[model samples]
Target: MGFWSTLFGGGSPQEKAARIAAKAEARAQREAEELAEKAAKTDGLFERALGKDPENCSYDARQKAAIKLVLANETAKGREAWLSISRDYPNELAHALEQVGVCYHLEKNYRAALENYEAAIRVGADAGHLADNMAEARKGMAAIG
Candidate 1:
């Protein structure tokens, strides 16, 4: 079962919160394990992807591996890589920016996330998701400010 399933399974109020925290811990452990696995393979596939034309060559697979690098590599490298994908591939820019937005949100930088999401919308991103994310971000911004 997924984290949400484990957390929200039938329970009393206190039991529910405990389950949620435990589920979060388990998910963190799983993510850490996956990050470790990706780090082991990064030296090869990650380097091979660098300086390569991702257009016809398929950036989809390459981009995913690069995303994993954010956890292992310094912030500059990950931001640089993401920026490259976004700039060089206008066709893929929206998604790339969306990914960056997610990275910022993960880091608790809501303003940056909203900015990136707005950029994605301006670039004709998946409209449905953009709208929903925009609403959520606005709610967050309102709450904080």
Candidate 2:
């Protein structure tokens, strides 16, 4: 119908297949680049998070490692790292619990998310943010049920 379509043989099955394949390849290339970029950043973050040695990791390093794991989508590891020192640092504990809840929510584990949020509240995290997160987790759980 259009001049460009006519010139490009828009009705041709072979042309459509070629275009689709090319699009898919382009998408794959973009995804690969994105993944590589994410890996590079995560690697740097992990290195910083493990400063000195494994046996003598600092509190700051542990905190950073928890954050890094969350960023890298290693939710379980991140959650554990956060929980490990949560009691020692109430503020951080609250923050960590809230973040872990968010990660669980993203993974569609609404029960875990709700549990984390509740723990955050119990640990006296920022009341405002924790309350909001708890409400959201509850909503997510309800939606699933």
Candidate 3:
């Protein structure tokens, strides 16, 4: 076999292709397994943060747990958690809406981010605090358009 052939596994064209394909499949499998493990770990952390009785937890505790998920880069999950909190705790609706807006912002859904941010302000979030974030969302929207 030539140097190239030997270096590339010393096989016929079809054999080399098969070897490459097998290697790619194995790599994909490994990646999938790693992702699954990571998801499990994240879920465990989320569950622990929420405690055994999430429904009985205070709004502050629930909000902290949701914020943890966002800090961990689980934006979608964090958004969902915040939305749930908003529904379950009317007193804290503005803050929860603001957090959901933040998650949408992180995900680059500028329109949704703006909508949520506005909703938060209307519901009682400090407009001064949310102004920068709303500006950023507007910038993102302008860029995409």
Ranking by TM-score: 3, 2, 1
Predicted candidate 3 versus true structure: per-residue lDDT over 24-72, tens digit per residue = 9999999999999988867864663444345637766677778878998
CA lDDT of each prediction against the hidden true structure: 0.70, 0.73, 0.85
Candidate 2 residue-wise lDDT, 46-137, digit = tens: 54444424653677776777687787787765666666656555557777788778778768898898888888778776667666666877
List candidate 2 stretches off by more than 4 Å.
1-33, 50-81, 84-91
For candidate 2, list the clashing residue pairs, or say none. none
**What are the per-model numbers of colliding residue pairs?**
0, 0, 0
Which of the predicted structures, 1 or 2, would earn the higher lDDT when compared with the native? 2
Quote each prediction's TM-score.
Answer: 0.54, 0.56, 0.70
Which pairs in model 1 have colliding backbones? none
How high is the lDDT of residue 126 in model 1? 78
Residue 142 alpha-carbon offset, candidate 2, angstroms: 1.3
C-alpha displacement of 140 in model 1, angstroms? 3.3
**Candidate 2 residue-wise lDDT at 40:** 81
**Distance from true position, residue 47, model 3, in Å?**
4.2
Q: Which residue pairs in model 3 clash with each other?
A: none
